[model samples]
Target: MNQRYTGTAIFLHWLIAVGLIGVFALGFYMQDLPLSPDKLKLYSWHKWAGVTLLVLIVARLAWRLSHRAPELPLTMGPITRMAAHAGHWLLYGLMLAIPLSGWLMSSAQGFQVVWFGVLPLPDLVAKDAALGALLKTTHVTLNYTLLVAVIGHVGAALQHHFIQKDAVLSHMLPFAGKA
Candidate 1:
């Protein structure tokens, strides 16, 4: 099996990484702004970006199911393999859940999600202040969860590249050599 992911997979991985980082930064910084038009504008960008991530993750998951991913190195320990699998699944779960929660929260607040000035996403729940508040809380909570997972993911990648001197990190890079 190839040790490096396909070009499409590599592209998607980096694209999502850059996008998610931008979204996270926007999310964090936007909250500090006073209630004003600028803050609302920032939130608009954040919301669209989150929706984009949701779409990309769904597509990535579909592609993954159809194609075999690059294999781990033969010398990788069982614990490492387990950790890798668990981390990936956790990332996948969070990626899907966070955007969904955001959408639901917005819908509950009676706002339609406009996807990058394109189609409007339908609401998943009825309008209710209490429910909206709950969803908002859930969204914020999941954001923190996502932050931690992302930090762990990045830390592990750096560890593999620097400490283990393994191709685990390189495999996700577009220029990585084939197995």
Candidate 2:
């Protein structure tokens, strides 16, 4: 069996990774900008990226369900294995929750999500300023939480590569080989 992720899996992973970084940066940068055409345009782009990521994540989940990921190294302890699994699932959950929360917040704020400035997405909730404010907080909190989780995840992967001296990180990286 192949030690690395399938091409499609690797592609989707990197695509989503880059998308997340871009959208997250855009979101933060645009948030504090005074209301203007540029701000509105950035919001639309951010929303579009988020929607695209939602679709990509769903596809990723489907692919993951149908295919088995490589087994964890035998040297890792049961507790460590369980923690790794939990961290992965947590990432997936955040991936899903963040987009839905943003959509809901948009709806609650009386804004419709126009995907790529063309397709009109249905509002997830009725307009309510109170709920919109709360969802805004929820979305931001979830984003920071994901940021922290991602940092830890990357740290763990590096730990495997540098400290554990294992193939754990390379297996997920396209064109990567053990050092």
Candidate 3:
């Protein structure tokens, strides 16, 4: 198996990573502001960013399905393989769920979700205060959960590279040397 991921995969991986960090930082920082034009503008940007992530994740998922991922090294134990697979699936799930929940929450509050200020996305549910509150909770919870998952994923990658000296981490890098 190749030690490095395809160039496209590496690009998408880093792109998503940057976007996630920016989105999360914006979300947390914007909350302290009083409702003003600036606050509204920040929220608009956050909403649009979330929408963009949803679209990109869909494309990423399709690409992943079509392209085979690099194989784990032969020395990897079954437990490690299972954990890796599970972690990847969890990341995918969070990628899909976070934006979706945010969209639902926004729709419930009767806010339009415009994609990058051009395309408009249809609402997943009708406006309802109760449902909106629930979705807000879900969205916030999922965001933190995603943060933890990302940290764990990165930590594991570092472990594979620094401690195990395996191809696990290298497989996701574009120009990684042969294992």
Candidate 4:
């Protein structure tokens, strides 16, 4: 049996990872910018990226649900295995939650999300300043949570690859070379 993720899975994983990083960075950078056309453009791009991420993550989750992921390495301890499982689900949850929260915040702020300046996405919530504040907090909290989780994930992968000398990380590498 193949131990590695399928090519499509690998592609989606990397694509989303890169997109998340970009969106996160853009979100932070744009927040402090004085009100201007440039900031508005950045916000639009940020919304577009978030929507794109939402679509990709939904597809990724659907694929994951239908297909089994490789089993944990035999060498992994019980605690490590449990943490790995929980961490993965947490990542997936954050992946969905962050964007949903953002969508809600936008809707509450009475903003329309136009993806890539093309497709228009419907609001997830009604416009209300109070609701927008709450959702904004939720979105920021979730982003921070995601950032921490990603750090832990990277650390675990590095541990598996360098310290444990295991296939845990290599199995997910894009150019793993020779099944």
Q: Count of backbone clashes for each model?
A: 0, 0, 0, 0
Predicted candidate 2 versus true structure: per-residue lDDT over 1-179, tens digit per residue: 55777778888888888999998999999999999999999999999999999999999988888888777888999999999999989999999999999999999999999999999999999999999999999999999999999999999999999999998888789788632
Which tens-of-lDDT digit does each residue in 1-179 have in candidate 3? 55566778888888888999999999999988999999989999999999888888888888888888888878889998899989998999999999999999999999988887788989889999999999999999999999999999999999988998877887777676665
Assess candidate 4 and give its lDDT.
0.92
Any residue pairs clashing in model 3, and if so which? none
Name the candidate, 1 or 4, with the larger TM-score value. Answer: 4
Superposed by TM-score, candidate 3 places the C-alpha of residue 155 at a distance from the truth, in angstroms, of: 0.5
Q: What tens-digit string does per-residue lDDT give for candidate 4 at 1-179? A: 66888888889999999999999999999999999999999999999999899999999999888878887788888998999999999999999999899989999999988889988889888899999999999999999999999999999999988998888887778998643
Colliding pairs, model 2: none
Between candidates 3 and 4, name the one with more favorable TM-score: 4
Q: What is the C-alpha RMSD of each candidate to the true structure, in Å?
A: 1.4, 1.4, 1.2, 1.1
lDDT of 3: 0.89
Candidate 4 residue pairs in backbone clash: none
TM-score of 4: 0.96
Model 2, stretches more than 4 Å misplaced?
Answer: 177-179
Q: Candidate 1: which stretches are off by over 4 Å?
A: none
lDDT, candidate 1, 18-126, per-residue tens? 9989998998899889999889888889999999999999988787777787788777899989988998999999999999999999899988888886888888999
